[model samples]
Target: MEEQPLISYQHVNVSLQGQEILSDVNLELRKGEFVYLIGKVGSGKSTLLKTIYGEVEIDAGEAWVLGNAMRTLKRKDFPTLRRKLGIVFQDFQLLTDRTVHENLKFVLKATGWKNRTEIERRIEEVLQQVGMENKGYKMPNELSGGEQQRIVIARAILNKPEIILADEPTGNLDVETGRRIVELLQDICRQGSAILMTTHNLNLLSEYSGKVYKCEHHRLTETTNS
Candidate 1:
């Protein structure tokens, strides 16, 4: 039998403060697949991602992520579900007061990693994966925007999540840097993690082929052309 999708949603309605943002949304993400969510600002791209991560509650329809039913997901179950997923933000939300090593270490510790040696080993591995192994001692301010974003990506994969939700991860970088980031994400996907990324950069779509979904008019639709 075929495996179930890592994420699946059908007729999902999402709202905030009594205002509906997304309606009748249907989508799926499978392992090792790379998917893109493209739309104008405030078109509900981020909100859609929020629902998958359980930040935004699903008002109607079926939504499942990593085998958890999001529509009936409880608040206490959020931490367990989140541990199985990774999230990368556009702004590079690294702790400003900590070194790259400490930042990664913090996540490992918070996620129930008890062994000091294991934590160090995992931190080194993720940094190396993102090509930031040597910069772990540096502060967040010491790195360029691209470097900082790399660290952010590294942080996302620390727990070896089943899926990654990246919200415009390349939004603040130059063309070349953004391309590099996308390449890195593709590499991660190939290693068996599904990725659902939101972006306004259409150029990257042409460079890297994948499933594309457009969010517009409070609706989601698959697109053949970027």
Candidate 2:
């Protein structure tokens, strides 16, 4: 039997401020799979992610994410839905006032983690996974763009979320740094978390391997790697 998709969107449509952003969108992501959404800015890449996480409402069609119905999700249930998924952003949104360890700890506490020992262990594990094990004492501004992104990934995985939704995660880095970030995300994906990332750098498409989808002319179309 085939594995069920962690996220699915069929004939979905979305609009913002009376402008149709996406139409008849269809996509699926399974466990341990890495998928990319490549498109120009304002092509609804972010909008799609928003819909998955319930930040944006779908105008039409059916959608499901982690068992939650996107077309009819409730406001009070937002936390319940978000807790099952991780999100990575293009800009590192780390707390400028805290150390790396503190930032991770804050998320844990907010998410209801109470045991100090367990929180420390989980944070250490994620830091090591992202190759930031030795920099947990530093503040966000102290790290380079790539390092900051690594820290963000570490935070995203602290709860062991089943799916990771990344928006332009490599958009702010240099070529080599961006490649490294993608590689790290791929490694995480291999370890079992499905990832759907949006990117403008088609250069990544030629190198890294994954299911590629393009958002253009108000449609999402999967493209083969060339």
Candidate 3:
């Protein structure tokens, strides 16, 4: 039997303020798949991901995320849908005042993970997954750019999200660090989480082959080669 796509958007159109930013956008991401989202500035890369995560409203088509219809979502319905999604950012949005453990704990609590023991275990598991097990107690300022980004990734996975929607996740890191971070996200996909990352790092994309989706001139295009 054919399996359902992890994320599906059909004939989707998104508008901001009063301008149509994206039109006729169609996409399908399956379980464990890794896809790259690329385009120049204002080409709708962020808008596309925002639509998937309910950050933006689509005025004209169907968008389904883990089977929930995005076009009809309510404000209160965000948490239910967001629980299945993990979003990573390039700036490594860590709380400068909190320790890694505390940062993870905060997210766990917000996501309804209340058991102290389970929270600790899940935190450890995700940190280990990101190769930052030894840095859990360190404050955000104590870590390097790559380590901080790893912690951001760990925070995203605390709820065991089915897919990660990353926005320019490696944009601020060095080339080598960017490659490492990308590899780490790819590894996450192997464990069953689909990844949709938006990046302008074409060099990394050239080396990291997978499905490619580009936002350009208000359109989404799929690349079959490279």
Per-candidate local distance difference test: 0.94, 0.93, 0.90
The TM-score that candidate 3 achieves is 0.97
State, as a TM-score between 0 and 1, how close model 2 is to the true structure.
0.98
- Best candidate (score: TM-score): 1
- Compared to the true structure, candidate 1 yields what TM-score? 0.99
- Cα lDDT tens digits, model 1, 128-161, are 9999989999999999999999999999999999
TM-score of each: 0.99, 0.98, 0.97
| Per-residue lDDT over 1-226 for candidate 2, one digit per residue giving the tens place of the 0 to 100 score | 9877999899999999889999999999999989999889989999999999888889999899987888778899999889888999998889999999999999999999999899999999999999999999999999999999999999999999999999999999999999999999999999999999999998888888999999999999999865
Question: Which 10 consecutive residues of model 2 have the lowest summed lDDT?
Answer: 66-75
RMSD of candidate 2 to true structure, Å: 0.8
TM-score preference between candidates 1 and 2, better one: 1
Q: Which of the predicted structures, 1 or 3, would earn the higher lDDT when compared with the native? A: 1
Clash pairs, model 3 backbone: none
The CA lDDT at 167 in model 1 is 99
Off by over 4 Å in 1: none
